[model samples]
Target: MAANESADGSLRAPEDFRSSTCGDTKSLKKSHLACRGAVAIAAISLITAIILSSILFAIWGAAREEDPTFQNKQTENLQQCQKQCEDLKMMLHLATQDSRCRLCPEGWLWWRRHCYFFSVGLQENRRWKESAEFCQEHNSSLVEIKDDAEMDFLQGVMCNATKFPFLWVGLTDSQQEGRWLWLSGKDIQDHLPLVVQWDSDDRDCADLRGDGTLFAADCEEYGPWACKRES
Candidate 1:
């Protein structure tokens, strides 16, 4: 009887030890899971903070780009308006001069120490060489444009004149086509009178239609012209 009791007691003690070991292992596992959850939460919070900061920075940059004073639409519009006003003023001056100059009906316009004339009403249309002679007969040669105001004035005058009749002008490519030479013997700059219908390469002489601007035409064509002399 005593030996049986001892064996039973020893088996009970071993079972109790195993239960305690199992309980300790479960507690350790629960602590490890809690630590992992805390680490994950910290990582998520850091990422969210970074994302929010980036969004704020982007919004600030966009606002700066849209600033009104630095990128003002009104300023651009005002500049365009000013330029148009200047052009209109110049046109008005030319129109007034055109009307006043007609009363004189002289060889050239004497203004600001210069002479200007549109030769479209001359008696005959001749080659460029012949037109030069005709101008010489009047103690003047073909007209020369000296400055921007003069060119603008001439453009405005020609635009106002009748379109079909041709006038002789001072500019010609007599020396070389595409290389315009004025009566002043200087290369014609880009600022000279430009007609809508330019002459072909073979047509070196410049003539003005009744419209007042100069155009290139065949030297033999009968047309009016412009002549100028120093005032």
Candidate 2:
């Protein structure tokens, strides 16, 4: 009976030791699992921050691109408004013309309540001032340049005539060389017609060349000339 009791006590001690070791292993495994979960949560937070930063950067870039486009559209709208205002003023002037006007003479083209005459057959080429006097003989003056399109239209009319090789245009620097003043006393140096053949420095006078274009000419030379009048 004593031998049996001793063997049973030894077996019980070994069994108790195995149970304590198993409990320690289970505690270590639980700690490892908790550490892995913490690491995974940190990684997920880092990814979310990166995604938000990318979205913000894209929004800022898109706003920068749109700014210039919006300003360009606004400028276009302002220009259109200015053009409409000018057209309205012209229409009002036209409406008032009937109360104070009569028919223009023959051989004269009527435009903007004024009459323009082209003396194509006149043979005498005179100085610009002399041409102005010739037009005054018929109660008129030298042609006045109103705008770019009007000047271009006058150039086209002069070009059509084959009979007059050249004419004295009402543009000259006789009063002040290199400084052209129109008959209306408006500074025409800036608005002087473009010369197809530019002259040397000594040629200060202006005349319409044979090609139906304006050029500097000798004041004493003779050529056909243009005249203008108001209706």
Winning candidate number (lDDT): 1
Using all chains and alpha carbons, the TM-scores for the candidates as numbered come to: 0.44, 0.47
lDDT tens digits, residue span 161-187, model 2: 675455565666666667666677777
Model 2 lDDT, full chain set: 0.54
Count of clashing pairs, candidate 2: 2
lDDT of 1 by residue, 1-231 (tens): 001223333222233322322234345446545555555554555455556556555555566467756335444544554555555555545544542223122445666655565543323345567667766665568766677677666666667766425456677777777777777787666554454357687688776544445566777655545666543
Each prediction's whole-model lDDT (CA): 0.55, 0.54
Best by TM-score: 2
Task: Mark the regions of model 1 whose C-alpha exceeds 4 Å error after superposition.
Answer: 1-107, 120-122, 156-165, 190-199, 209-214
Query: Model 1 residue 158 lDDT?
Result: 69
